[model samples]
Target chain A: MNVTTGQSTDAARAIAAGRRSRRWGAWYVTEHRLRMMRTYTGTVVIAGIGSPLLYLYALGVGLATIVDANMGPDAVDGVSYLVFVAPALLATAAITVASEEFTYPIMLGYKWNPTFTGAAASPIRPVQIVDGVVYSVIIRMLVNLVLFYALMVLFGAAPSPVGFLGIVASLLGGLAFGTVIMGYTSTLQEDTGQLAMVQRFIVLPMSLFSGTFFPLAVFPIYLQWIGWISPLWHATELARVFSYGYAEPIWLTLVHVAYLVALIVIGWAWSRRIAVRRLNS
Target chain B: MPAPVIVARDLVKKYQDFAAVDGISFEVASGESFGLLGPNGAGKSTTMRMVGAVSTRTSGELGILGLDPDVHGPEIRSQLGVVPQSDNLDTELRVRENLLVYGRYFGLPRKLVAQRADELLAFAQLEGKEKARVDALSGGMKRRLTIARALINDPRILLLDEPTTGLDPQARHILWDRLFRLKEQGTTLLLTTHYMDEAEQLCDRLVVVDKGTIMAEGSPAELIRAHSTREVLEVRFGSDHNAEVGARLARAQGADGHRVEVLPDRVLIYSDNGEAELVKITEAGLRPVTSLVRRSSLEDVFLRLTGRSLVE
Candidate 1:
């Protein structure tokens, strides 16, 4: 207990002489979170590459083969069946990745690990922590999109040069979905299987019913409203327009962009407010 | 005189109908080691959180570094370091990374943060363990890292809530030593603790809080001197007979000025001279299985003020 090398006092005084900068602290949190992400980089990369490849094979190659054979080569929208479904898959991948990034990790930030509290105690504010987490998740989404797109190109699923625009559409869809999940996470006091409920109820249902695997027109009109409300469908429609020049009215395309943008903006606002309130309390 | 680093005037924190902290007022001066001493749920932690600028007061005039917390929280927080009751270290980061990241949170330059991280690791006696994961470290190591991380920004004031709560005696001593060094370097420290010995060792001035109110406040020596006797004579005459002996001792003529407190396991006879008082008790034909005379501590003062043992 009395073990002293006398460096502590000198170090303490040195620290006392240290200076503070007014630079944005959220980037520091983002850097810290990014470092944490590195620990799971191997798994993240594998899953990023593997999931899209499998989905493209199963949905685009396998399912599309059967659908195209039944309906001819220009089956759904005068493009290959693989291309018709590729954009939707990209949007679904983004949403699912966003769901994973936002839910359990946000819960961990609040409950499991409480690393956010440590950040809150510093000069960094709660809003910055919220921003930092969202920013890092977006970074992850970008990487995931890159992997998904590379696979789409490999399988000849993405044909048009304009397909690169799907990247923006896919990322917007992710942010819109992720921010709301984050906002919900901030209100959680305990796990109690709420996240599992979200995955089972909200995420899975949205993925299945959001016209990811098939066009919304194929669904009965009664259930087609799900596609209208779901951010996945909005992004998928936008991505399809970009990916294969799938024709759509300009106003409808504007509506898709507007809906996803609205969700992102509102979700960002709510999550920031809730996170700051919870951290302050 | 310069304003104290922290001042709370009738601070209140309410959660629905229950008040975690009710109308408590206190001041902590610059470079002074102050404490909020109380058992768990007594609002010591709540008070620390408010002073740390993380928790808002329900209704009160509060100031940190002469700045209003409500109006200048970020600015005030920039000048303070806080070690919460629980270790909230980023378990995902290595020990050194923890310090570096915390420094970054203060918006320090990356190179400076790296240099400070090295120095801090050494100061925490964790130099060799810099690359070790926080989860892999011992409880003591984690605590030291937390303290080291807090100092990364050279905060004007350091707030610690139960800093050594779960540590072993050896670890506690090491932490105390590090805190002592920080104090010697003129860092203003505000800590909360249920440990009476810890308050005595660290705080130059402290307030005894109970049930969301300040029971008493003074330096350890002053508090003990003012509230408790110079010494205490503790005697156990079997748990069953303690109350009986206490009643007799209370009624005895010569022990009039002394205070006798009966406990479940023993009887405490408070007097200026405990040895002499014990002699008097022995002469009264009261034989005890065991007895000890020791100087009073902040624990005695807390018991005197609150009518309950510090631990209880």
Candidate 2:
């Protein structure tokens, strides 16, 4: 066996220097998860840069031509079809990023790798673990939103300076969707391909029906309810209002912001509860 | 007397109608190494979790570092180091980062944690492998790193649940050596293991647990002496006829001052003078296939207490 002299006394001094404040513990948990993110930085960067260009090229440039030829240019919302669809695409990006960031990593924290249990053994509270994970994902969403927003700018998608407000709406929309998905994922004990089903059934349908490519007014009254419940739709409408000054009443704008805020609060509370329950159980 | 770092009075952890850890009481004094000896399903891990302040006790008093686990869990946990049954090192992080990140969980300064990480890597004999990914490391390396990570907080008391369960003999001995060093440094240690030799080697005192209850509590030597005779005589008369030999031995146990236990493959005769007992058995016109006499161990004590082997 190999023998190495231990600096037990120095190590003890260092440990004794640790802060007992609860907030630092939460920050440290966030720090650790952020480092975990660095392992897949390549994938993150590619997704951040690639997703927006593909959507803009495929939908804005390619599909916009047919819509323009049929409806005449500026037929929808008094702007070109490309400009009108851009804000919704940004909202969709945020929601897509939210769904991607929240599922597998949360499962890894709870089950596959059980890194959360390792943190649970430390001084950090269980709810802080939830906060830390959500915090990291929000940061990831912000980055993705910024990169996509920049692409939207370079592609001539933004027609007004207030289009930047679309980024805020996208983030709120992501949190509303991401944190709720996070709460649901934390309660899962087994994978069983459910997240794939979520992508297939929930995320896909929400993106398609949330008026990302077309206005909800074009849909029949019954089918428009999908846009009402969907966070993406609320965010898209809010973004359009900001991006190209898409007309809407003041109270209706407040409803969009309130809906996103409510979803965030509910999702935040649920994720905290589920995380604590699972860790202590 | 030094204060007990951990005290549990009638500790009970009930899951609905089933008590995972039934009413059991014990204390671990500062700097004293204690063991919870039990087989699988014995509630040792459950008790350890309660003491570690990770799992809530159903109805019991568990005071860690003289603080109530229910109210001061995070505070108490800040001062304690816990090594769970399985090594849950972050496979995504490098070997050194595992210690640094875990140290930060205690709110340690990153600079200090980084400095201590190097020293701990050396202490755990993982010096050159600091940059290796955790998943890329061998089992022994991973266990050593886990131990090092637990020590990042320099906890006054360390709780280890089956620390060396999956390790090979060499690895187990290496880990035992590290734990012995920790004990020598006056770190209070609490561990759970079903291996009798592990209990004997590391524990200054131990409590035998089975089916969620404490069966006996004492030092390993004292438990062996109290619950079993000084020596155990093993006599195997072929699997087919061992039961017949065991029955004959049981009939003579009263006169011989011994006890006979018939197991699946062999019969164990508990007696002070095992050689003399073996001679008496052979003199009764029974030629055994093989026989040996050895000093009784904690395995014998557990068998005498529960009528079952410690590791089945």
Model 1 misplaced stretches (Cα beyond 4 Å): A1-23, B253-255
List model 1 lDDT by residue over B1-312, tens digit each: 645767788999998899999999988878999999988899988888888878988997787765666655666777888888889988877888888878888777789989988998889999799889889999998999999988888888999999999899999999999999999999999999989899999999999999999999899999989998888999999978888987888777334777887888898888888888888888989998899999999888888888888887
Q: Candidate 2: where is the Cα deviation over 4 Å?
A: A1-21
CAPRI-style quality class for the chain A–B interface of candidate 1 = acceptable
Top candidate, metric DockQ: 2
Per-residue CA lDDT of model 2 for A1-281, tens digit only, reads 10111123422332344346365677788899889999999988898999889999998999998988888898588988889999999999899888987899889988889999999888888889988887888788888889999998998989899999999999999999988998999889999999999899999999989988888888999999999999999999999998999999999999999999999999989999987787776
Q: Where does candidate 1 clash, by residue pair?
A: none
Model 2 C-alpha lDDT per residue in residues B84-185, reported as the tens digit of each score: 899899998899989988998988778989998898899999979989989888888899999999999788888999999989999999999999999999
Looking at candidate 1, what is the lDDT of residue B224? Answer: 88
- Candidate 1 structure quality by residue, lDDT tens digits, A163-262: 9899899999989988988898889999999999999999999989987877889888999998899999999999999999989999999999999999
